[model samples]
Target: MLFRQLEYFVALARERHFARAAAACYVSQPALSEAIRKLEHELGVPLVRRGRTFEGLTPEGERLVLWARRILADRDALEHEVRALRTGLTGELRIGVIPAASATVTQLTDPFCTEHPLVRIRVETSLRSRDIVDRIRRFELDAGIIYADGVDTDGLTSTPLYQERHVLVAGSELLAGSTAAISWAEALDLRMCLLPKGMRGRQLIDDALATRGLVAAPQLESDSVATLLEHARTGRWACIVPRPWVSTLGPTAEVRVFDLVDPVVTAHIALVTTAAEPASVLTTALTGTARETDFATVDRRQR
Candidate 1:
């Protein structure tokens, strides 16, 4: 089957809509449909479940999509390698980032961008670490910034970036007489906002609280760090956030920051990429940038 046909099939599987798939491929609906039909004929296996409207992929299609993605990724890597030899790296580098690392991802990307001026970078933030790992396996992301704890990195190359320290933040009024460090129990006693349980950051917090025989029953829960920080600024809620975020978001004068003690929780964050041999040129470059980068110093500078 031709690469164009594989591209159309993968787009159809991703979009799950014939019209949208065609739009994504920049082709007419009939052209995309015909391409997939030809691909099916070549493979001697039906790829799509046919209907008046778009139906999901067939079992064979589901199985073949994985191979299709790998083939396309390899093809793209070859093209990138050749292009880099002639004119330096020139393509989009897509990275998935967990919410906790959103503020500090610039430490890695900044240097990568400086060295590879022709390369464009796309950072997708607020992703769960598991989701980021899954996307990397599927070849959707060149690399990811994610928590290294409790995450399966069996087939991925993980390079430790930094330790993400948790901190308690609130308005000056809410913590009017608080010390430099607050216990987990004390932080939980106040009206609090926290990340939802599904996020890795929130899970870390939950685990830490569980050790102290305390459960977080925050009055407000959100996925956005900025939202939690904003609520903290209102002097109505205390939020636990990554210390690095305080530097990037810059807590206002009324906001107070305190270390989380009595079991200070820290999550190891890493840059993860697929462990496939002969790594893509962009992924190699990103891995190099990650190695040379030190986010702890960056955070210290920001502070």
Candidate 2:
């Protein structure tokens, strides 16, 4: 029943290992286990399945974890609000963002921090767009920057931030200059390296290519954008990336960036948050700044 016990339960559920969960909670293994036992006794339902080691949570535990997370989140929000009233807006604002939208988070934070310099910002990058939505729904993230397409927005609201235009980046061998734009078909024939098919960016590219009845056969598949760009720098392979991500690199003489045409597929990136009213002070600030700020103005100068 205690908040500390719920915290331990949630940590255990997340870690899926008792020792590691205890370590994360800064408590000994036995202490964490005993706390969970007490929690289960108070609730009159077994939260965890017993075994030799840390087994998975029961169905009831899974449901309880969700409620526990919401309770903790509300508790934190109350603290943040009271503290903000005493001083100013001051708390950690956690943002989950996909890899392509990672560089664009500063567009929201820069203006937000200027208004409330006391707030701390943390951005988790390279997440699947769907995962970002899930985490926000669970209150694990204050907000997220994700693609608007193909994401479940049932309990959430989105504010459009910017449009992501696909581009092809290649070394000198494949593309000699940055002057010309190439079709998705032309780009696919070359030796290419790209993100995995599971990523939102890759899915967008694949969907666009499918319209032309083509499939991607990458020379290399990587989760990191830096890796793809590194290969492209060698002038041996070409990669597809977002235009804004390319813009963050400024002038890249080692690589050529060409716009993708012949059905230019664009995805709108938005700031997504839970639709619950009376958002935490930090999220309110972020959502407010995102609404008023112009992405082009903030992003164009980011480089």
What is candidate 2's lDDT per residue for 1-303, written digit by digit as tens?
499999999999889999999999999999999999999999999999989998899999999999999999989999999999999999899999889877678878888989999989898998988999999988889899989987888989789998877788888667664357888878987899999988888988999999999999997999988788888888888899887766655666777878788789788999998888677888887889999988876435433
Off by over 4 Å in 1: none
Top TM-score hit: 1
TM-score quality measure for candidate 1: 0.96
lDDT of 2 at 267: 89
Instruction: Output the TM-score of candidate 2.
Output: 0.92
Model 1, global lDDT: 0.90
Which sections of candidate 2 miss by over 4 Å? Answer: 177-179, 298-303
What is candidate 1's lDDT per residue for 190-287, written digit by digit as tens?
89999998888898899999998999999899999989988888878889999988875563686888998879898899999988878999999999
Which prediction has the highest lDDT against the true structure?
Answer: 1
- Give residue 290's error in model 2 in angstroms: 0.8
